[model samples]
Target chain A: MDEFYHLIDWALCLSGLIGLWFFFSRTGGPLNKAQAYMSVFREKGIYNPSYGLAIAFVYALLDIALSIVIYVWFYNDYWTDSDFGIAHLGRVILLYTIVLVSLHVFLPKIDNRHLRKTINTVDYHKMGLSMAAFVVVCVAVEYWLKRFVYGMWYGEESESILATVAVVASTAWIASSVYTSLNRYESIKNASERTLGALKTRHAPIVFLRSFVLDKPQRKGMTFDEYICSTFALNSQPIVSLSDPDDFLPTGGSIKIQSTDEEWESAINTLLMECRAVVIFEGKTVSLKTEMAKIQRFHIPHDKVFVATPPQNYRLAAWNDGKITERKYTLNYIWNDFVKALDTYGGMHGLPETDPGECMIFSFDKHWNCKAPVKKTGKDFLGYVVDQTVVHENDKCDYISLAEKLNRFELQHTQVLSKSDEKRIEKAIIKALIMSALMSLAVILLIKLLVK
Target chain B: MTPTDFQTIEESLGSLFFILVLIYYFTQLGRLRHRKKLDDTDGVKKVKKQMLWGIPVFIVLFFAMVLSSSLLL
Candidate 1:
């Protein structure tokens, strides 16, 4: 026991000496440059492989020395001749391993982005297993120290309980640490993505699907409802419906369908003055190409006049020049292609470019119930259009953007909300308070349980 | 060992854990300053994660040690 104390004293002295040496060396010379490089490496989120590895090595040695001191200090002060022998140390080690293993298994599953990054795949599995192994090794070493270096804890009951307490407390600390880390990671990740995504989306174009009627519906033509639905589906717009023309139609707009070619031509002229784009759907009896050619005599650009026909499956050569097979019509694929074609003319800024650093984002928040408006730079406007659907179809609330919601949050400082909004925020706060209270109670109970 | 012995151990451990926590917080402060200097967020999450784990562990251990000593007494 005396010899162990001397060893620990020597180890501590050595650590202090090294620390002091580094402090002075780095404060006044070439070592400062090395430190600056290390700091840069850390800042870039790059693991200074050599430095981290070195730190880990030093930590391992320091930890072992500390553990030996802990064991020796406990043995000399408390455990004499009793049942609390090396075997008791083994049980304590096992308990520590169990708790660590539980954290390893559970912490990663909590689903927080900050925590996820910190506990990356390699770290998660490796650290958990290594910790368990470390516990076992610590126990073995404690046992060896007690058995050979000092004949202690052969039958000490009090020391046994004390040992148990130490192990239990340490394990509890580790588990709690994991939980806390996971939560912090989540909040940080969410805040960062929300801020950046909002900034990016702010400058992007606001795209709206505009529809105008062409030749007034002939008696054989599809109803406005069916036509609009099919067109929207063909265009692959995220908008699900505009079935109620009352909801979308421009106020004071007149509607009339011409049955004759003479009436249709006049209707087309009138509709052209009133709207931006017109759709002409020709029934199977009409030759769409002939009618389209006549319209083109007016010399409108071909891109604005979108034409659709019934699909027919046929064989075509594959890209690899292998045998071709008949393929079915896919509205999803066709609409994507249509969007691509529109992008070429509108300048392809209509698609969301994949952001490498930005993480999975929920476009709306529960509290604000608002969708985020898209922001984009002029470069983004030239390059890609980001389109996002904020609210789920099944959700009852209307979409609100994050920027708008942030504005709403700011509003709370001034005027009071409506009775219903007040009630909603109040309910949320109450729920949060209740959850926090419950968690506190659970933690208290767990501490009590683990102590026993 | 008497209850007081356990109490002493608990108190010392509490202080030790606090010291460890303080060390960690100082390290984090340095890191945050460095990070803010560079205007970056990359891998900051990892450091935050470690602090999250480390800070609470000290707190829990401090209380646990106190409670265990009382129970033992």
Candidate 2:
């Protein structure tokens, strides 16, 4: 038993090390799964109340099964002991059931609130203190419960109990993270689908074109597509994009059209003719340039297409020791390549010269006439600019500016949503939420009964 | 090797892992602070906020490991 315990400890330590390494190195894990699940939901039209409840129930059953397997494996000896086995298992299950219920009920609300606000320094400090207090409280409760409630019977085997709890809690935490990611994906998909349905009625769907790099989580943990969707969630038309050839799962923000390499050009041409607005994010790819040429050939109205220029460079002001110093970001190879490609294509000819160390998005009109570049100002959901001291002069063009420009155009053509359409979407979302909540409650009650 | 020797090696590895993790955490906090200062975007600020909790939890974990080792000894 001592040797087994030692082995388990070593395995845990090694696993922890590997998990940290994997987290830092990988980008596609839960996000990819969420995206894949969203794709399936869209294809199957499974966002209804009954479907949501079924999915939640399936996940809950899986969690219970996994937990049981782990518990029995760890306490195989204790199972035969009988006095402490079933009773202790019951308590652990009860604790986990509470956690699962709270996760389903509160996590979505917290995530929604997080999406709507700009976190500041005071908020960070408060969050830190709260987290510390929560941890302390959890530890205290566990210690008190073990000492006063079950410590007498399981006194010698406290270590095993603690280990089991740690394992169970870790598993539950991972499961909850996945669940939350999927829930967020579902919400985004729901909003996107609703917008698309509205736009289809008017034949004015927004078309989003970008280099594949924009799909990646660059310096920001979020993909540019996600940033755009969240920024314009309330007002903008549904944005759609061609799925990247290499992507296994469609990215979250834009509705992705799956097409073959040979079919993409024809697809883009068709979309360009029908789309109300075209958002072209600057990129260096040959396909993007080809698309640009096609846009020119199609003679798309200048007001209908918006070209988002990339930042030339960024200037970061940092405090080193006691003194403040300015540091200019070195031009990355990709940006340099992009500039050269744009220049060669004469796409940069009439555009305003971007200040050497600042980001701006320049809109163009018909005959390739350029508008004044939009500069970052005011606070939006992501707090575009919070501190005056540190300036992101070289950061990518602000999504808020792009969103504002698009929304301005969209509002000109916007018709107020009919009462029926509005009510239908709202009812669907509410029903799905209620069903999922009921399913969670049912799972918790079932677990409680089984444990008893 | 003897069991004591294995135990010593394990303890050393554990301590080293914690120390490395602590260094990484501090570095991340510094980068986030710099990003918050420079960009001050909500995303950066949110991540920096998360680090506030992250730092405490990691520190607590480190201390717990040390305490557990001492108790075992």
Q: Report DockQ per prediction, comma-separated.
A: 0.01, 0.03
Give the alpha carbon lDDT tens digit for every residue of A302-419 in model 1. Answer: 2233222211110111110111110221222223333343333322222322221111121223221213323322223111222222211122222234233323222111111246
Q: Which ten residues in a row have the lowest lDDT in candidate 1 chain A?
A: A314-323
lDDT, residue A171, model 2: 42
Q: Score candidate 2 by TM-score against the native.
A: 0.37
- Per-prediction TM-score, chain B alone: 0.64, 0.57
Docking class of 1: incorrect
**Most TM-score-accurate candidate:** 2
Error of 1 at A239 (Å): 19
Best by DockQ: 2
A64: Cα error in model 2, Å: 15
